[model samples]
Target: MQTPPPKSNCKSILTCLLVFLFFQVFTGTLDAQEWAKKMFATLEHDFGTVAKDSMQEFRFEFTNLYKEELHISAVRASCGCTIPTAEQDIVKTFEKGTILATYNTKAFAGARGATVTVTFDKPYFAEVQLQVNGFIRTDLAFSPASLAFGEFSLTDKPRMEFNVSHAGNTDWMITDVRSKNAYYEVEIIERTQLVNQVGYKMAVQLKGNIPVGYLQDDLIIVTNDVANQEIKLPVSGKVSAPVTLSPSSLLLGITSPETEINKRLILRADEPFTIESLTCDYPGVTFRTGSEAKKIHIVPVTFNAGLSPQKIQATITAKVNLNGEIILKCPLSATVE
Candidate 1:
């Protein structure tokens, strides 16, 4: 401060600052690429030429090379045509995980490309994008591609309708519809037949006795196309329970030892019911219900972090009075720091 810096000296100082900033940005980008290269064996997959109505899948395997634990927060695809799934989100040092990419050739035809982005939060924040490309021939066509029954009750039978059409052969027909699940029944009706086209209406029914939870299966449509005969249609829906728990998975994040954490959960049902008991396998967890009993309920859960840092996996079971005692299990997870 005694002698203010000259103009040239100030300019040199400013140039040094700019160089430092640029070096930091460049190093960051290089670090991210190095991390990804050490983790993934391959970052792209091409399906070349895939047959229409055929299922194609690829797995991008990665290993955690860092000493700290790695957790994948989310895996998203650029298009709805490609479905990406993470086998396990939390990976320990030297452990392995997989990113599964499923391409729906029936729903999307021609040249298609999608990029799957995997975001990591634990240890540090980072993102890696994987690319997938494929070409689907247009021999067979399904109107809806898959059967979605939406949200239906366990006591109600749901029905869905879709169409299947073929381009070249008018004699093409669906020989039979088969499913391994006994809860599903199918009926096919011939709608039209032309010189170069053939079409049919398919009616799929779900029985009323199906259990409550998410439903995901495939219906094999055996066809007369000798070259490509078997066509699979994915079936998905949720069979909601009479009593439902909102926010089924409660994550308490990171907490200090001996700290008390409380969270509120909402229970909804189609009719009035009373909670008989609420319990958890972990000794440090407890819950309490409101005094009033109706179609909606508020349950407050308390968790006491133990004396040491550890990971917790406790299933909170709730017994409700319906036709009989109905037990619902909600998974709860937390990390103590």
Candidate 2:
């Protein structure tokens, strides 16, 4: 038989256990911090001098050197001036990921800075803080900051003009305009060159015969200022079809074999026109439209599923009389079982 320990001795033992647990928790937190430091390539970024209203981004790359998978649960910036994003959260052993931090130059002007904190919850709990610093000069300004072309016909050429001014140096000249898009034509004219101010008139033209879809592009204005050489202007608009189709793609969902699926489509135009003909490439797909010409017309389309399970894909072409023969296409698809 063994003698039992005294109550005081038991209490001492329990206290020692608690202290050891505390030590483990504290050391774990320290180890996590150390791991984060070793994983990141760099912890700080200085953007030097950046142009106002220009979009800028920095990538903080890291690799999971440990054998275990590393998960980044959350990435957040201290202020709205900076937005942080992770390319991927889970990184396997020896894999890499990037933390993208974008600075909002439009909302934040004249000396902006923020701290981004990245938190990891898996493999081990850890947190890494990154610092970014930059200065935005107030000397350059744009009247509209951005360009919007609104809605335009594909056959019609559209043009827009805006002004850029510099209050710092009078000799600040726009040396060149650069755009990768072949459809855009840009022209810059010096509006005024005073003792303490300089101004330029910028004209952007969208050529006719551009592809029918949305237009989102940027024009880079290269200037004589060495510190801030390139300035970006955003251009956005939609190039609309003269003859538009609502629900451009007809979806019949899922249907049983030999069943019929009926759907309605709306065809519209800015001006009144007549739909000369409508046809579908698929064997069992058909459409019917009214004979009268109008700005808007509704057509009822039907799809007949054969006696088998199959996937359907077809193009519906509409010939319309608007100035000339305008051909509009709508895609049709369905699954039959």
Candidate 3:
């Protein structure tokens, strides 16, 4: 053996090792900010030219791809022309959230833009900026601003009408109306021309072929104005199933054999509907419903664990009246301990 190192030198070497490890961890945290940026698919949206007093909205959607919970610590907008909001605060892994940027149509007009900053504190601190800009014409406006269809069934063919007026120009005319959505059809039903003013009455109809989900689209109107060629109208509605089910899938966590669980299955429709029958092939699973025809029915289901512990996977089917017979099915899952 030649010699052993001194105690002070050994201590200094150990300190260097600790510092190297800490630097690695700190840099890793800084790199995670890039992960937050990766969640957004796009960073900017241009609303172009829109009619004043009309609804202009855009959603900056982001999904959490990490294992940790993604969170929005704060949300802000650079100007009052664009109002920003978070759909929720904390989003779990693989789930989606939206940063809604809504233009302030009632109060402000003319060209406007905003920067929406979203701050995340969890899964590492990060900041994301989203941009939106639009030219809101004061001379052009919609009487109702937007087409809101609310809720309706697939069999119901609904039509709504609104008027668009342009001031300060007598020669202004709507050349044509256009829509790229197959489920919704839009057209100019009437036109009124006056000295220094022009107007149009437009109608939108929801077709029967639309599936059950939220309906959202923009109807573009081509105008004769050389500077601004198109005006957009936002349309929103929901095409609901005659017999709708809630909770998506039943998630009954681990339980004991002596447990008797009571759960609810909510059924709703756009119109008054009656459930002709409810069936389930799962052993020890039973259900009961009301007999009256109504817009909603609450079906109470009871689950008995029997005498042993096991996993349960089953499906519940319901028959309803929507001009004829319509079937709705839902999945049920549970584990007994």
Q: Compared to the true structure, candidate 1 yields what TM-score?
A: 0.54
Candidates in descending TM-score order: 3, 1, 2
Q: State each model's CA lDDT, in order.
A: 0.79, 0.80, 0.82
Best by lDDT: 3
Q: Name the runs in model 2 displaced over 4 angstroms.
A: 1-78, 82-103, 110-137, 250-337
User: How are the candidates ranked when ordered by lDDT, highest leading?
Assistant: 3, 2, 1
Give per-residue CA lDDT, model 2, range 186-286, as digits (tens). Answer: 88754788879998887888876455566666677788888778776666778877888878667565678999888888989878999899998888978
RMSD in Å for candidate 1, one decimal?
10.2
Clashing pairs in 3: none
lDDT for residue 281 in candidate 1, whole number 0-100:
91
Against the hidden reference, what TM-scores do the models get? 0.54, 0.46, 0.66
**Candidate 2 vs. true structure, TM-score:** 0.46
Write one digit per residue (lDDT tens) for candidate 3, span 40-59.
Answer: 97889887788888988888
Q: Is candidate 1 or candidate 2 better by TM-score?
A: 1
Candidate 1 structure lDDT: 0.79
Q: State each candidate's clash count.
A: 0, 0, 0
